[model samples]
Target: MKLKKLVLTGAAGRLGSYLREPLSKLCDELVSTDINDVGNLYEGETFIKADLANFDDMMGVIEGAEMVVHMGAIVDEAPFEELLGPNFVGSYNVWEAAHKHGVRRVIYGSSIHAVGMYPKNEFINTEVAHRPDTFYGLAKCFTEDLGRMYWEKRGLESVHMRILSAAQVNNPRALGSWLSYDDLIQLVTRCIDTPVTGFAVIYGVSNNDRAPVDNAKAAFLGYRPKDNAEDFAADVLAEADVLDPHDPGHMCHGGPFASVELGNSGLAGMNVIDDRKKS
Candidate 1:
C-alpha cells in the first residue's frame, strides 16, 4: 500500500532528522511537525511548528494526513511531574487526533524502558508485560496501552516499535542494545508499507551479536536489520568499567536512569551523543 500523505511528529528530533529525506521518497507529501522551528526543509516536505500536547493545533495540522508517525515527547528520563504533560498528555492528543481525523495507522516509538525492570539476562519478547523503570518508561507504557485500546476499540491499525536503543555505540550496554539510524529508517518504512497490520508490538533491535532481546517476530514484520555494533565492541568494552551487578544503574529497570538522582542529567550520564544532524 502506498502511503500518500504522512504526518510525522518530533520532526526536529535526532531520529526524525534522519527520517526526513527517506520518508519523502515514499510519500507524495510529508508534513513534519515539532515544537521547535526546524529551519532547513527538504523537497516534498512541509515543516510545521506545532506541539503534540495542543489537541486543537495538532488535529488541525493532521486533518488531511492518511497516517501518523507519533514521535514527539520528552526523550530523557525525568521526574513524573515533568513527564506528565509532554510524554503522557501529548501522546493522548496525538492518538485522539489521529482517530478523530480518520487516519488508518499510527507508527509509535516505544522503548525498552517499558519493560526495563526485567533482568537483562532474561530475554524479552513483545508479549512480555510492562514493568516501567522510570517516569519516561511509564509514559511509554501508557502510550502502548493507548495504541492497543485505540486499535482494538476504535479500529485503528497500530504498530508499537519497541525500540531497544536508538543511539551510537557508547558503552558495553549499548553494544547489546543499539538501533542504528539506517536500521530505524528501514523499520519505520516496513511499518508504513505493510499490507495488513493489527495491533503489532515488535522489537527495534538490530542484528547485534550481543543483543539482549530475541527478535523472533521478524517474520511478522519482515524487518531485516543489516547493521551490527560488533565493530565498536572492543573499543566500547575497553572504555567501559566493570560495574557491580547490585548497583541500581545495573540492577534497576532503566539502568542509569533508575540510578541517577531525579532531575539530574539521566541522558547525559548515558554518554549518548545524538549527532544525527547534517553538515
Candidate 2:
C-alpha cells in the first residue's frame, strides 16, 4: 500500500540521507525536513527547512502526511540545556504535530542507550525497564513513554526502535550489536508497513551470532535482518584486544555512551566508520 505522503525529519542526517530514496519509493510524496537545506533530491522527494525545537515548524512539515519518520535531534549526550531544545522539546513537537495532523504512525529512531546502563553480560528483551546512563538516553525513555501515552489516549501508533549500532562494524561491541545499512532499510520499511503496531519497543540489530539483545516480541513486524556482524568479528576482535572490563563503556550495552561523563562527548575514543554515501 503506497502512502499518500510521508514526512522524514533530520533529512540531512547520515541515516536520514539513506532513507530518503527508499522512502520516496514507498509514498506518493516524501517530504524531507532538516535545519539546513538538502540540495538535489530523488524523484518524488521534496525538502523542507524546519527547526525541530519549534512546535509550529514541526507541525508545518508534518501536516498532510500519513506517516512520520522522526530522526531529528542532538545525536549525542550534551548538557541538559543544550538537549532540551532538539532532543527533548523537538520530540514533543513531533508527537504533538503528528497527533494534530492525524498521522497514523510514527517510526522513531530510538537508541539502545535508553537501556544503556544494563551490563553487556545480561541479555535483555523489549520488556526490560529503562536504565538510561545519560541525559540523551533519558530523553529516549521519555519519548517512548510519551508514545505509549499517546497511543492509549488517542489512536496514534508508534514503533520505538532501540537501535544498538548503525555504523560500520569497527569494534568488538559492534560485533554483537551491528545494524547494517541494508538491514536498517528493511527494519524501517517493516515498521512503516506493519499494520497494527500500537506503541511498541523493538531492538534494531542484525542477525549477529553474538547479539546481546532480543526482538522476539516484535515478530509481528516481520523484521528479519539479513546481515551479520560476524563477517567483521575477526578484524574487530584482533584490534580491540585486552579491553578494560572496569570501564562502564566496555561493560554496558551502551558502549562509549555509557562510559562518557555527563555533558561530555561520547565520540571521544569511538573510532566510528562513517560510511554515509557521498553523491
The candidate that achieves the highest TM-score relative to the unseen native structure? 2
Task: List, in order, the clash count of every candidate structure.
Answer: 0, 0
Write one digit per residue (lDDT tens) for candidate 1, span 1-279: 556799899888888888888887778899999998666888888988887878887898789888888888889887788888879999899889889999999999888888888888788777889987778888999999999999989999989888887889987778878899989999999988888788888888888998888788756778999889998999987888888898776755466876776656568778778696761
lDDT, each prediction: 0.84, 0.90
Query: Per-candidate TM vs. native?
Result: 0.95, 0.98
For candidate 2, lDDT tens digit of each residue in 138-201? 9999999989999999989999999898988888899999998899899999999988899899
TM-score of 2: 0.98
